[model samples]
Target: QTYKFRLYPNKKQEEQLLWTLEKCRLVYNDMLAGLNKEEKPNRLKLQSMLPELKKQYPELKGVYSKVLQYEVYKLFSNLKGLGELKKKGRKVGRLRFKGKGWFKTFTYNQSGFKLIDTNKRLKSLHLSKIGDNISIRVHRKIDGNIKQITIKKHCSGKWYANMVTERNNKKHDKKISSVIGIDKGIKYFLTDTEGRRIENSQFLKNSLKKLRREQRRLSRKKKKSSNYNKQRIKVARVHEQITNHRIDFLHKLSRSYIDNYDMIAVENLNIKNLVRNHHLARSISDVSWSAFDNMLSYKAENANKTVVRVDPKGTSQEYKYGRDLDRDYNASLNILERGLASLPQGLRKVTPVEIEPLQKLETISASLIIETGSLFQNHK
Candidate 1:
């Protein structure tokens, strides 16, 4: 698990952090330049060049050793990512050197970092090169051994520290009981098999007026001027606000479902392909279906629950009854049926109820709709 905390670095410490980031970027570019010249690039050879690099450029010696080495690892990781894309027949580009202000993060891997918990609410993160006593606000207690700490500077001029940790998770033997299938949409955030609906909180859409005003103000400023930089941060703040609101809503909604259900079934949507449709792209992005699915998966694993992804094909189009069923509700039922079918025979405890008469299913659906409407009204 990774825990992110707000960092409050002093002016001198902030300058040190920025200097380290720039130094790491330079090292990354230097290694890339060397790799391009060589017929066969070796990781070890590139790493060994660091000591010599410090001799040539003595400023690097001021930065932490492992922190500089991580830049090499990051370079190869990018190369591997590009290779995977090329294997899938996608157009790939070579890694380019980072320009000024482009690099915003630096990592202290395995060593050169310490977390000191004061008796007070605030903690301090100590780095090797950067000064100690950098106040950190850890909202929640961090469990497990910390593997690394990555310091990042946001476009909004905020600093954050992400602590990656390692821990052995105990396996949970939970009996499959409550089950649900959810169909995601633009109108409602989701509709479940039981006809419950959660309204979509269009954070980006709601803030577009303010965002447009900020952008217009930014556009009026001269490029690379002090005013331009200040206005740029104002625009970034609006985007940051939208992101935080969306994430908070998703966290609460996903947590509610996880707390109530044992198994959750959802459509395995190819979000990248769906976003290609220009008309629906904005709505789809606003809904953030992929982010919600990811939260459910991770949270379920921690709780020893189950999350199943069923093929979305014909889910909305196929209906059993002669009368028209709600598209999202029908899709959710199909999803639930498919989810149960995919489970092992012994584990498949609850099967979809088979209602022969159309009138009975319609009545149940109507009643559920009314119940959900009341709940939404109360929530509002």
Candidate 2:
């Protein structure tokens, strides 16, 4: 598990952080230069040169030694990922050198960072090279043994500490009795088997105008000018706000469904394929279906609930009994049917009336009942 906390650094500490960032960036660029020259560029090999580097350039001594080593490890990790992607037919590119401000975060894989007074209401973070007394906001409690800490400087000029911890595996004991199906869409965030519709937050769409204005101002400023750098931060914060809002919405919605439903069935959307349509790509990306699915899987696992994915083909095109219905609702019904089909006979007892019809101007309750009943009859 990982928890993020806001870090409040004093002026001296902030300068120390900036100096460390610059040294790490230098190391990264040097490694990239070696790689570009077809050198071995191994992490161990690169790390052994750090002592010589610090000796030659005293500025490198400002950063912790382990933090510098981690930069070497990170470069290799990224290279490995790129190689794997290329194997899978992706268009791969060579690793590039880090420009100023491009390398925003650095990690302490196992040492140089610790927590002070964790049991108390207020806690502080200690960095080995940087001074202690860097105030940390423990907004929420976290558990598990800390394994690594990453320091990130956001373009908004805010700092954050991300701690990666190891926790004992949780055994799920919740008994699930209720089930629900969900259909994802751009029009509505999601439509469920109970005919509940979650409205799309559209964080990006709502903030695009402000983002565009800031971005335009940024482009107009002379590069590297004081105003340009300040405007750049403004643009970054706007983008960050959109991202944070979307993530918050996804987390809450996924948690609510996981807590309430025993089993969750959803369409298996091929998002990569769907996004190929240029016209719908922006809208599809905005919905972030992949991120939602990932949250559902992890949350459901911890809650001892089931998440079943069903084939989406023709789900929105036709109802089971050939009655017309809302596409999203119809998709949800099909998902439930497919999900229940795999359960044990004793647990699979959901009936037609339990699934509600989508809202409509003219009532179709009678036809809905007959259509649902006929669906089971035909299947049985």
Please name the candidate that would achieve the greatest TM-score relative to the true structure.
1
Superposition error at 123 for model 1 (Å): 1.3
Runs in model 2 deviating more than 4 A are 38-41, 118-122, 172-175, 342-380
lDDT of each: 0.84, 0.79
Q: After superposition, how far is residue 215 of candidate 1 from its true place, in Å?
A: 0.8
Best-fitting candidate, measured by lDDT? Answer: 1
User: Candidate 1, overall lDDT?
Assistant: 0.84
RMSD of every prediction: 4.2, 7.3
- What lDDT tens digits, residue by residue, belong to model 1 across residues 1-380? 77889999889999999999899999999999998887877888999999999999999999999999999999888888988999999998888989999999999999999999887778988999788999999998788899999999999999999999887789866667788888888888888866676677688898999999999999999999999999999999999999987877777677777877889999999999999999999999998999999999988887888999999999888786444777778788888888877877666568666422222221122223234533333332
lDDT of 2: 0.79
Q: Candidate 1: where is the Cα deviation over 4 Å?
A: 354-380
Worst 10 residues of 2 by lDDT: 361-370
